[model samples]
Target: PAGAGQDQTFRADDEPEHGDLIVTEAGVLKVLHTPGHASNHLCFLLVDQQLLFSGDHIMQGSTVVINPPDGDMKAYIESLYELLAESVRYIAPAHGFLMGHPEAVIDFLITHRLSREHKVARALGALTPVDLKALTAKAYDDVPAAIHGLAARSALAHLLKLEAEHRAFREGDLWHAIHES
Candidate 1:
């Protein structure tokens, strides 16, 4: 039922960009361009209530996947940091129930991603010149084997972020970590 309406073509009357305000009967919703989950991801903030309508930017119980070529780990993390400047008290995620303690949630997400990145770097360092599959296995050993395929996608996102920072490099399909001398 997820793609049930894929065959239908729908058009929007008005395309709302980042920073656009949508005033509804409930309150004024400010559009926040929070990329990284997908390049065009947007989160709406209810100005009066300090509640964020987080659409895939933040999840309630589970972390969202960061599949690359569309998902950028660096951008996702940066977007999370940007939310800290906002006066968000509640998050109404696309999936699951509304969440409270917005700042703490954002902090935890950032810390968790950074910790995962560190694990990725360590795994890459230990298994240099390795393929994504191998690197993911080493880095995400705690993750169940059934979901390694999904984990590899997030691992690739991490590797891309590391590569952007010059902390890692890729040759063909293999990834190599850059060590400081």
Candidate 2:
């Protein structure tokens, strides 16, 4: 009732912008729309507890995949900045251990995503301009074979941002490098 999924379910409404803070019976929580992992992704900051419920926003063991249309790397970076300013003490991720140092975890997730952007660039260089599938393989070789599909989604995220920036092109399931002008 008080502290429930209302803050999460209605996150996409343009009415509540990104920085709206919601107070509940449990604690004071802020609604941070941290896209990139997903279009409707949200992270809640438990203000009094100093604990951040990262949701799918981040995890301990695995990198959060970014899918296009719903995900934006730029927005994710902005969300990180918002969280950093909050002075979070601990992070309770949706799929990981409670993080002792919240800033470090946020920094690590942001850095890893930036590295993925670089990897996508390198993968493009190694190939004669490949499609999303091949690029996903090269960029995410560290991930399990079964989850490469998940990696493909993450690759698509970077590609979408790159395409928006005019650095990549996507035709059907394929993606090709576009020389920046």
Which prediction has the highest lDDT against the true structure?
A: 1
Q: For model 1, how big is the CA root-mean-square deviation? A: 2.3
Clashes (N, CA, C under 3 Å) per candidate:
0, 0
TM-score of candidate 1 against the unseen true structure: 0.93
Q: Which stretches of candidate 1 lie over 4 Å from their true place?
A: 1-11
lDDT of 1 by residue, 40-86 (tens): 89999999999999999999998988888889999999999999999
Inter-residue clash pairs, candidate 2: none
Native-to-model Cα distance after best TM-score fit, residue 54 in candidate 2, in Å: 1.6
lDDT of 2 by residue, 1-181 (tens): 2236456455534544466888799987887777756766788888889888899877888876555567677677667777788768998999979889877888887787788888997787677368888898898888798988877877777877777778878777667887655
lDDT for model 1, on a 0 to 1 scale? 0.94
Error of 1 at 104 (Å): 0.7
* Error in Å for residue 3 of model 2: 25
Off by over 4 Å in 2: 1-17
CA lDDT of 169 in candidate 1?
93
lDDT of each: 0.94, 0.77
